[model samples]
Target chain A: MTTDLTDSILYLDAVSVSFDGFKALNDLSFVVGRGELRAIIGPNGAGKTTMMDVVTGKTRPDKGAVVFDGSVDLTTQDESAIASLGIGRKFQKPTVFDYQTVEDNLLLAVEGPRTAFSSLFGWRSKVTAYQIYEALSIIRLGDLKYRLAGSLSHGQKQWLEIGMLLAQNPKLLLVDEPVAGMTDAETEETARLLTSIAGEHAVVVVEHDMSFVRALDCKVTCLHEGTVLAEGTIDSVSANDRVIDVYLGR
Target chain B: MIKFLFHRFDKTAAYFIAALAVLGVLIPILNLALPEASTFHIPTYLVSLWGKYLAYALLALALDLVWGYCGILSLGHGAFFALGGYAMGMYLMRQIGSRGVYADPILPDFMVFLNWKELPITWYFFDHFVYAIAMVILVPSLLALIFGWFAFRSRVTGVYLSIITQSLTYALLLAFFRNDMGFGGNNGLTDFKDILGFSIQAPTTRAILFSITALMLALGFIVARAMVASRFGQVLASIRDAESRTRFLGYRVENYKLMVFVVSAAMAGIAGALYVPQVGIINPSEFAPANSIEAVIWVAVGGRGTLIGAAIGAVLVNFAKTWLTGTFPDFWLYGLGALFIGVTLFLPKGIIGTLTARFNSGGKGDTA
Candidate 1:
């Protein structure tokens, strides 16, 4: 629990955020090492999503330090700025550019100059094309690359969203409920995909499915009342009396 | 350039440009080269009227760029158009020197009538055609940049943005109506004598202006098409569909919106500049919010996102308005309202969108 903030790719120290009278995050602190994968499990209102929002700059923490890549303060940056700083986030619900082709969605997310001027003159370069193809293959969406994202099935859309993150090639990825509406087989495939992505980028996956968490086979953090209640291996965290009483309902 | 053109213009766009080109050359030839006795001859008055429609077409195209592609739904687009017209009108007013009814070389007739001792500083350098031309592009673009910066940065969107844009044009309408504003007050800028030393009422001038209007519409179409076809356009489409997703992808959404908004305003300004010379007047009525709403209708009826369709809708609607007003002036408003309701209920995609969808589906069925 006492990790060096400078040694981690993402360091969140004593972050707290409140909405009106409700505390979404209460003195939450955690460190994600470079290329490490962490699974967050909690009941409703445990602030798992709020923690992502704070780190991704969607919401400002009332008090805490969010440092990315060691020295960059994420609190002062906006969503686009934070994204450009090599932090990518996938929403709980699949959100893709519905009208655009799957390939164009990945193309838009591909790392490069994000200014209007650059986009105006942008053409598909060899490297970008290669990256897109690589992402498409990884997500098993290569054949549906030309199809409209809206037309894809729910699982396919989820994969396309993951593919978009891969195309971005961020140093850290925040994936929220990637398999929420997916089939069991699709969920297994997604677990495999996230495992493969872990060594190249730090991943913070927030999920509700214990089976899915076990499938990820990564370090588990159980949050309750806006703070971490347990942290250890999945077996240990699930075995904790407080985590089971509050979340598992044994 | 040839490769660029081929890549940018789809078949429909190519045909749209070709039609404009043919009309640009043919209409002038029919008016100027043929005698009035010949059936082929296009009367001077009709030429000017159609020229006005082409100008409206360009305005509608400008609106479509922001509303259809970017989902900005600007209801005050006429403000930019009217500003461009006023810029051209100021030059025309200056051109009337020594030839006006007041015959004042230093002041326009309206300024002289109001007994202004000196020309307003705003009117300075408007005497030069080059300055006026620069104002035509600059004035609207400047307004759009300032307006879009505030609106987009604040993330004002949907019907709320539409309401503000409507208020923007309405505010301009009121300001332009004030005589102290020195823009000819409620009467607006009129009494033009010439442009570039040619008689404004001359048939040759009318034909040339008509040709220019057609060319400008073609140019506007080409420019809009190029923007929407580029990766920039794809980003705009994404912003329209999923704005937050686009932001998460690292694009400065406000910057993209502002860029297109400014470009679209400039195009609308050019359309207004072309309109004034042919219409022989520029007035505060041009700034009426209703005028902007009608332009949006033209885009919607033709197909909101299709550049060619915007032009087609503008001409079609205006042509109908002319005929209906002449026959049943009292019923024109009702007719327009009914038409809009009918299009929304039966053809939500507008004329071009529905037709293209049908054609595409039919093609797919044949393959299947």
Candidate 2:
């Protein structure tokens, strides 16, 4: 099969995954273009999270190829290898190391020698420090850098996880439900942050809040039953009869 | 390692090193310089016992490196300790030369008793102290590397990993008890004459061994402290707190586990090598799963993540064990059981953790 290599950073061709004979992903073909920000909106069981799992190499598709950066096959790599290949995923639930300080959380996520030997003896350079500082300012957790991540509020924890994702400096970022538990103000801030991040790196955000999606103001893809139901601007997609029926009909 | 120690010397770590240094100096003086009749003088037997305790502390420190830091709870650590002990025991056995009961130049007495024709090929290079020392570190590390590679790569963790580790030590126990294993079977290795040409029973040698044990404990603490303070240590702690998160952050979690597991095993092996010389014997009992469990309890009681706490837990619990087993005899195990239960329910953070929380929070407890 001849695949278009230059247009997209990630392409999933008819990807299908089943768990114990139950289809979680059903022949879902999708693509995310380079340096593009895409918002995925869907109902509870529309397979949004499963689609993310497939991209992050957390789950394998029984059929179809997940091509990354045009030529790299994501299906052939494990989670760590996929992560190291410049793809970072933020989970739906915030999962920061609660016991460590916020600064340390960022440090652990920093791109450098990740091996045991290097960490034991590796020198932290000026560039690494500057990157951590930049991340801290981006996440707005500079004042609480020394505080344990466990002590942070839920919204703050979500931001910290996002900040950690930023620290990885990946070419692609898969953020799942970033504003799920966030307040209105925090959600708006996240919208701005992710929007600003999109131009420098390709970002795929799976979110539910329509206002937040409107705030994103990017190309929106509405999913239903593990396939793309609608793809357009926020207003256009929301105005689609099919998209409206899929959200309200079920 | 020294750089980290000097740069990151905190109160807890500093106290640990100071205590070791003090003990190292005072014990040698009390046993050698001070008159035996003086109340301040330490008896020779007591010195050896304390030396054994220090070695146990080192073992506990090693356990804390993996368990407390990286969250790999290995209950088969005693097997590594015993393997290192056996390596040292082999060298000592060779030192016995013609002094053994059978007086065989090459074969140890137990091998002669078992009617073996010659020294087993596995025991060949152990006659050399350097080779024995190398084996003392290498054998346990190699075993840990292989075991951790399989276990971590398969994503076996928590209680399942603990169970497999326990099974490993139990397996070693059974094998070492077998006559055909060529490790002296049920009797194991004992009746040592010398180590590196120094008389094993000499007071000066015992004092030297005690000093060496203390030095080793200090160095182990420094190395472990430096490790946990490093950036690598940060990732390890993250893994302990959230394994999948660390994995998705681009860390090869299994490789990290294997590395720490092998390092901890090597440290445990060194502790065992020091232990055999001070205790003058190496037996299959050292490989008992219960011994490993007791070591875990020591870490729990002292506080798991605190390196100094583990060392303190080992020395204090073992000191109490020596005292209680003498006075109350059968009550010792019950006391230990109660302590474990009490620590779990009331002091989940253990002694050091609780104390630190109090100190840090000014007794508020919430900050902890």
Candidate 3:
């Protein structure tokens, strides 16, 4: 069946990716509407991350179309090109520039010229400074702006990574396990942050934390063996018998 | 432009430049003005030797630009250095002009010795100083651009990239050693008589070369400092720390790597060009992989990411080499190996890195 791509910010239709005969993403058809917030849950090796990979152009699917912003094909672009097309990703592990100051990390993410020459000749202008300041306050790390990113605590780094994504100001954000090792309070805060971010940008969050997903309070997609098993409200997807059998487990 | 260049100047950079300027002026005076019998008189030989050290320091600084901040461990940087040196060497060879044993005005003595009746096409513009200088910069940059383009685009990184760079220098070493390659074969280019109408052996000339070397090192240091201090530098450090994340941030990782790689090569080339005049030779041996690796060791010995540290490391290590080789030539290689091992073991951050960390007292140290 043909999928409608006109309205969705991201439309993945029957995308298949395999590695060494192992199907990482098998016929994974998913759509994220503009300004939509999505929570993807699955067991280990269930292709949730792989689906994000396919969307972000990190991995090229063996078959089917990966469209972005209604008509732009994502499959043909490299990661940087895809990112430049307004898709930002935060990895499962917090990957902040450790040696740089927290302020500099945010500065790098603030949208502007990404060319080497531009950067060499560029100065930190008022707009970038303001953007960084805003991001720092939002991430609650304003006081530690000058501190090295490596010195930040684990939770702070994750927030910093999220802040980096926000600074990027992409049309779509693919966050992977943002609250993986966070405390309950931090997890809730992250859920709030992701929720707050959704209305302006389509967000695809790959998460294993059920409570966090529930807290997201958005559309939920449960995957098993590379394809979508169930997708609906968190309550409905969690209640699905097959989702329970393969992911939630008895 | 001045403000942009000096924006990153910390106390260390200030001190480094101040010390360089003082030495640049003072050493030349002491050497040129002092009588031979005076105890304070610096010898011409010593002047040239120190000039050699300054050139080395520049090369190390170049390497640090790529390896330290960019995380590009180029083990073949000496190829660029040698290429620049050869360019300069060819100019020097042209200047010999009938002064050689063979008395061939158009060809160098080595070419005449090899019975080459005419100057090769590669030697076309060596007679012109501007052309030679341009070639010195262009050749290495072109090689770097081509080499970095393929390697970075293919995402060849880490030790694999390092290995390929090593092979690159090794390949150049073999090629330059060939008799027909027109670079004077394994004997390389030497026996210079004049540079810019001045006798190369003149004490005044030696002093001038030494001063110029110091000036170039300062220029290199400032340019490097400015680069690392800019927003572009932050991106490079990011790429160094996390390549994939930088890409995810929409940076063309290969493009960044390629740009820095080319710039670094050009710097190395300039260093080599300055070096050939001071040292009076440019041989295939300069293209040796070991030399590039040694340059890297100099950066590591000082501090990899720290610009001043790289310069300090180059001078300090070469100083040690000069002293040790003069005193105990047999054990110099072993000492170098041990020095590298010890630095890696105890001071992984290098001298400046460790010192800055200590002085920062747990505060943010310079240039993470």
Best of the two (1, 2) by DockQ:
2
Candidate 3, residues A167-243: lDDT per residue as tens digits? 99999999999998899999999999999989999999999999999999999988889999999998899899999
- Lowest-scoring 10 consecutive residues by lDDT in candidate 1 chain A? A120-129
All models, RMSD in angstroms:
1.6, 1.8, 1.6
lDDT minimum window of 10 residues, candidate 2 chain B: B359-368
> Which residue pairs show collisions in model 1?
none
lDDT of 1 by residue, A102-165 (tens): 8988988888888888767645433446888898899888888888899899999999999999
Shift in Å, residue A108, candidate 2: 2.2
B9-49, model 3: which lDDT tens digit per residue? 78878888989999999999999898989999999999999
Tell me the TM-score of each prediction against the true structure: 0.98, 0.96, 0.98
Error of 2 at A198 (Å): 1.3
lDDT of 1 by residue, B117-226 (tens): 89999999999999999999999999999999999999999999999999999999999999999999999988788999999999999998999999999988888887
lDDT of 2 by residue, A137-237 (tens): 99999999988999999899999999999999988999999998889999999999999999789999999888999999999998888888889899899
* Interface RMSD of structure candidate 3 (Å): 2.3
